[model samples]
Target: MTDALQAMKALIEEINHHNYLYYTLDQPGIADADYDKLYDKLVAMERETGIVLPDSPTGRVGDQLLKGFDEHKHRARLWSLDKAQNHEDLTAWHTRAAKLVNDYNTRNPENPLPPLSFVVELKFDGLTLNLTYEHGRLVQAATRGNGVVGEGILAQVKTIKSVPLTIPYTDGVIEVQGEGIMNLSVLEAYNQTAAEPLKNARNAAAGALRNLNPKVTAERKLNAYFYNIGYTDGLTFADHREMVEFLRENRFRISPFVRYFDSIEEVAQELDAVVSMRNTFDFLIDGLVVKVSDMRTREALGYTDKFPRWAVAFKFEAEEAITTLQSVSWEVGRTGKITPVAKVEPVDIAGVTVQNCTLNNIGDIERKNLKHALGSQVYIRRSNDVIPEILGKVTEEQDGEEIVFPEQCPSCGSPLELKGAHLFCLNRLECRPQLIGRITHFASRDAMDIETFSIMTAEQLYQELGVRDPADLYGLTFDDLIKLERFGEKKANNLLAAFEKSKQCDLASFLFALGIPNTGKTTTKVLADHYRSLDKLMEATAEELVLLQDIGDIVADSIVSFFRDPVMQRSIERLLQAGVNPVSEEAPVIMNAENPFFGKTIVLTGTLSSMSRDEAAKKLEALGAKITGSVSKKTDIVVAGESAGSKLTKAQQLGIRIIDDEQELLQLLNG
Candidate 1:
């Protein structure tokens, strides 16, 4: 590497660390004056050398934002790693790895393999960014949109101080891939000036990098830490750990924590250690990336199209945080249920700021004794991006005070009633939260399919137009919407069009939209199949409901209770009066029983030539095929593509029929 290039790499790394301290962790260890001096020196050096690296921060200086992002084809495919959520899955994967290694050793007696070892690193929860450097100079950067082609954010990425502008060149082109994310500290700073609350660090980094405004991306202060050296012209390593160490030596921002183990059991221990220390890092991590250490072994194992065969990700189940609950506040649901929401100190969990956690019901609070104490530390769990829930109170100081459940409606102050593990506010028509929540649900995608409707819009309709129930939504006219604050003629027309489109939703979806407690999509389907229409299902007795498949006593009673409520009856009548007629589905089209695939559980793997996997699954589902996620004892068929891996092996062992091509898939579905 040239002297200028060496200095540039060092300067870039120094600047990146400074950025990490200030922008990422919100702890600037160095003074602004000292940082400014280093930056000036870098600019002067760049000018003297007349060699501006592609990822040089100097290029970002005074650079205007591009009008739009353009697509850049990745030089190499960025394959995803297969994931294992539990020990059993990981053990299964490890067994497969052992088998492959044993087979390789058997094939080549002279080069017998050692016990399969792995290198583990934190699996960052963020967008994948590929930064390519040619002859030691950073040249291009792209988002890993579809593995092959990604939106170009070269200009935006140049502003990331942590990305090296140049490196020590000894070989051909180097493609470095990393997780690009805005940490919680950066999110806090950005939200201060942003018009909206950024959902999380990962999304914020993705959106910031793709923003048309380069300055905006710079202002957000994105960070990245390289994990894999995806492609190289002439570089080779005996193992993954050596290659990563080389990357670190060359001034790349590699992961700080790296460990190697000879056994899967040892790797599992490391995984636990990583999870325990995950929150202490500046970046967001969702799991641990475990890779077969030997490069030769990796080559022997090869890869599947969707995932690398030599590596797997042990993903964490949930993001949790312990925070003190300050007090309890009751909020009335659409069903007139007054649920407790524990207001807590703002805690970060699952990358989002949670100020309050749901207590479910009065019965739940009494059972857990959460409301019995204020200023008590509580376990808040955020699962699958759902609302945070207060799991239970944690042991803390004895000064915590007892919580008193409210006896009246939080919104309307009406006397509350107790009914089987729930506290209800009988003022259903008047409670503001109930009205808004119900209207929001009714207009939601799964319900009425009103795309233009939102919680904000629902609140406006209820407060301004007195939308007492879901049915009143149909009465909204363009003229009425035109009077709202942000709604103009075009917005009004769009909302009206959405409403008109929703009037045609089928019986199952409509039934689910009623917001019946404990009744989900499958329950709605069962109900629709049995009764054929909404009114028939509503008129049925609890005994009739209990007779159906999967319908138990509690669900039956809830269904009956909802239908018998006078307010609910009036709501349905209003919906009928508004011409919101739900069409019943005809008897399900019976697939020929003679078809071999009918009633068979099947799993799909790898890329198919004719159509996408999702499209294939839909067509097969229509023909009575059950699409499954993994290969198992119950899987009757396996669809294998060019690079199908572990699942294919499992299917072969189980002696299941393996379909090879899209043509075969089409034949099976058509027959």
Candidate 2:
């Protein structure tokens, strides 16, 4: 029994250390398979002995579903910070804090506080988490409920690998405050394969934490950043910097940025700098947090009824606002998906006047409880700088006119059908909007690379030239194009040249131009590389497709169904007849095993002067290289070009191999 306990203790400590290294430092001490073996051994030992250590790593994987969250009283109150919308508001806040500090110093001259220095950190847009540790062991984790109390979510919080199960600080009791967030890159990766894509990272993190199933939370792979030791029974610090060091010593995952500034003017300048590079961060941040550096000054400044006087949140311009929904219009996409576009009263958000917001579909409208929200105030947000989307109605009781869902296609008057969370019109060929959308997408830069092509051009060709399918574009001549309303001699000749140039496209571009449902550029590229020809891809079975990496059942089904459709087959026949020749230019007769880039995950960033990045990627793929968008520890090499940005910097920081010279890149491609 003693030997078993000792073995368990050793295993627990080793596993916890590895978790910290991998999650907090982004440095893996061991391979995943090796770590799993150690974990399996520990689990087997635990089961055999029927004894689990208090700080056992196995507890991170919560096997049982929680019925409900129990209320927990926090050791220290989680205070909210006062917000500063502009520089004026921030200046006023600093003035108030300085005044309070001066008054305190005057009264107690012998014990005068330090000069009013400030610490600035990013105000992460995520769920506030309070983790309570007793005798260095994490005992409880909770949400910030009314400052004084919170709902215990220990099981859910444990799933975060960055959060230490046991800290080096063997304090009596302590509460650490941090924000839990899902990285934007992680969110994008999740959305790619997820059946129901998560709308935003902030909401995704919050929803996962509050979920009844810890398994669901684990799947999200959330991360956290500890900023403050909210409560401590056996620790003291001279200033915020010292406290930060203590947090770091205890193996808490802190943000890389914790800049200290003595002058308020410097702090303001720093805020501006942060705003400029805010998008570069992997996580989402709404603003910067300016806090008093001196702990004694913070104590002297004290707290107000709602917010702490020592700190202020320098908030960015509002990205979300409530606007009255005037009407809803259903628009048809290239895939026949009917999307609901809500025309709202013009409201300014993040400096843009938003009059229209997306409701996604009828199902999305119903899911968001916006069925009876027309003419009512609806909450809208500009997600990822794209078109603003309607979150929901402000009032849940629905005190306005009902938003009627269209039973028929608005463009072609065909019967609409619900497939999952979207409404689809089966009228593919005749629908004006659908045909126009299809043609526009087919001529897009990433697809057919048809220069000077726009939605207006597609519309003109459809109406004036009697163009329907993408194949019709190939048949267009100078005489036909010159007859159009906007077509002059030069414009007609340029359009004809572009059309001719696009006919000799590569297979990957041609496949992407087809715009198969549930498939994007990446998947189409994969399909092209795997089959090496259009006929082979068209003949591929779902079973064979699923064998390819990243190609799931849904995507495979979408591919198979699209090619098997008689309409699509007829369209392809017409395209072939019109002299459109899409060749597999990058297909190697025999893949070389000795190639340096073979089987290596490579990333391309910035502008390549020799060739387009897409063209370079295809050449690399032919030599058996896998190209990814983002740079991470997993990335083997980064092919950087002129003016490489954050990705290049990250690659350098991670010590990944970089190929920056254009001549070197050209040699590699040619080699």
Candidate 3:
């Protein structure tokens, strides 16, 4: 029994030490599997002996579910900071603070406060967390409820791996304030597999923390970074920097980006730099917090009823807005999938007028509790230059109508089939929108490269010429086109010439133009390269297709299903009969280890005057350079061209190599 107790103690200490190292220090000394083994052994010992230490790591598993949160009184109030949206507002804040400092100095010459230096930290977009510690152990955790009092959520807070259960400061009681955040990457991963995807990171973190079950909070994998010591007994710090060091020494996760500036001008420049690189951060930051560095200065310039005079939050431009969801309109794609687009009352978001918001699918609508959101106020967010998405309804009162799902296709009046969360129109051949979309996509620049073929042309061909399918396009003669209203002799000849040019397209382009269910250009390229012929690709089993690098079960199934369709087969046969021959254009690429770009991940941004981005990507791929769409730390090089945007900025911030000169890029490609 003695030996078991000793072993349990040793294991507990070792696991806690590793947890501190991994979470607080960001320096993991032990592998995850090894750490888990140690944790499991400790758990087994505790179960056998029926004895668990007060601070045992196993307590963080969150087995207990709470009925409700008990209110906790904070020793020191958590004051909100005044907000400054622009430089002018920030300048005004600085002027007021400077004036207050001057007045204080004039009143008390002998005990004048030191110079008002500033501490700038990123304003993390998350839920506010206040952790109370007494005698080196975490006693309570709470939200910033009415400043002085909050709902206790210690169990939920403990599930956060980075939050310390015990601190080194055992002298007396202390309250540390921080933000509980769900990392953007973690949120994205969770949403990909979640039954109902979370709208945003901030809400995800907040909802997890406020949940009745601690297990729910643990599942979120929350993280916290302490910034302020709101209450402390028998502890004194000269400045914010010293306080931050104290937090760091006590194994608290302090942000590495805390910067001290003497002048507001320097702080303004730093804010700009932060804004430019904000997208690169794993966590969301809505703005920055600027606070007086010196504790004495902070004390001298006290607080108002709601906010501190010494500190201010610099808010960025609004990316979200609340607007009435007027109605829902279902739109069909080339794949026959039905999408619900919410038409909202016109509202401006981030300087753009947004009326329509994406609801993703019917599952998203139900999951987000937005089924009855029509005519109700809904929260809409515009981010990353994509179409705005309706997050959820602002209130649950349901002062709106329930969105009725269409029984039949709006365009073709065919029975709509519900597949998973999406509604699909099985009537693929006759559906106007679906057929038009497929034909338009086939003639797109990345597909068949059919010049002079527009959506208007497709519509005219569909209605006037009775062109039902892509196969029918090949049968069109100059006479058929010249008879149409706006078609002249030169235009007719050009259309015929383009059709002739499109017939001899590469296998990859031809495959892409076919509009296979889930297969994209990249997948088609992979299929073409692997098979080297269309016949081999058609004969490939899903099992064999899944063996490829990027091909998964979903894509493999899609490929097999597309090729086996009788209609698709007939369409291909008709194209072949019309002299449409898709041949493999790729010569064998020999990978050279000596090549500079070999095994490197490269991103191409902006326009390359010498060639199209696609042409450049192919050339780079020939030399063993892997092309990617986005810039990240993993990107080895960025081929920046004229008028590069956010990707270029991100590459610069990450210190990735950039090739801006066209001549230099040409030299590398040619060589």
Superior by TM-score: candidate 1 or candidate 3? 1
Which residue pairs in candidate 1 collide? Answer: 372-402, 372-403
**Candidate 1 lDDT (Cα, whole model)?**
0.73
Q: Tens digit of lDDT per residue, candidate 3, span 21-58?
A: 43323333433323434554666797697655423555
Clash pairs, candidate 3, are: none
Candidate 3 has an lDDT of: 0.78
TM-score quality measure for candidate 3: 0.46
Residue 134 displacement (Å), model 3 = 69
Would you list the C-alpha lDDT of every candidate in the order shown?
0.73, 0.78, 0.78
Over 4 Å off in model 3, which ranges? 1-318, 589-671
| Cα deviation of 227, candidate 3, in Å | 33
Q: List the residue pairs that clash in candidate 2.
A: none
Q: Candidate 2: list runs displaced more than 4 Å.
A: 1-319, 382-384, 589-671
Candidate 1 clash figure, as a count: 2
Regions more than 4 Å wrong, model 1: 1-121, 125-179, 183-215, 218-264, 275-282, 286-328, 342-404, 419-422, 526-532, 539-549, 564-570, 581-588, 596-616, 624-671
TM-score of each: 0.56, 0.48, 0.46
Candidate 2 to truth, TM: 0.48
Model 2 per-residue lDDT tens digits across residues 1-671: 54554455445544654554433233334333234445556767876875544335554321111225787878777886666767998999999998998898898887788889999999897878999987789999998764676779999999999999999877366899999999999999999999999866876887889787999999999999999988764355779999999899999999978899999999999999998999899998878899999876776787764468999988665456778999988777666767677789987653245676656556668889999988899887653223456778898887889988889999999999877666778898899988998898898756897877877899999988889999989888888888878789998898888888999988888988987865656677778878888888899999999999777676678789999999899999899888788887555725577778889999887678978877888888878998865675679999988767667878999999999998988877777
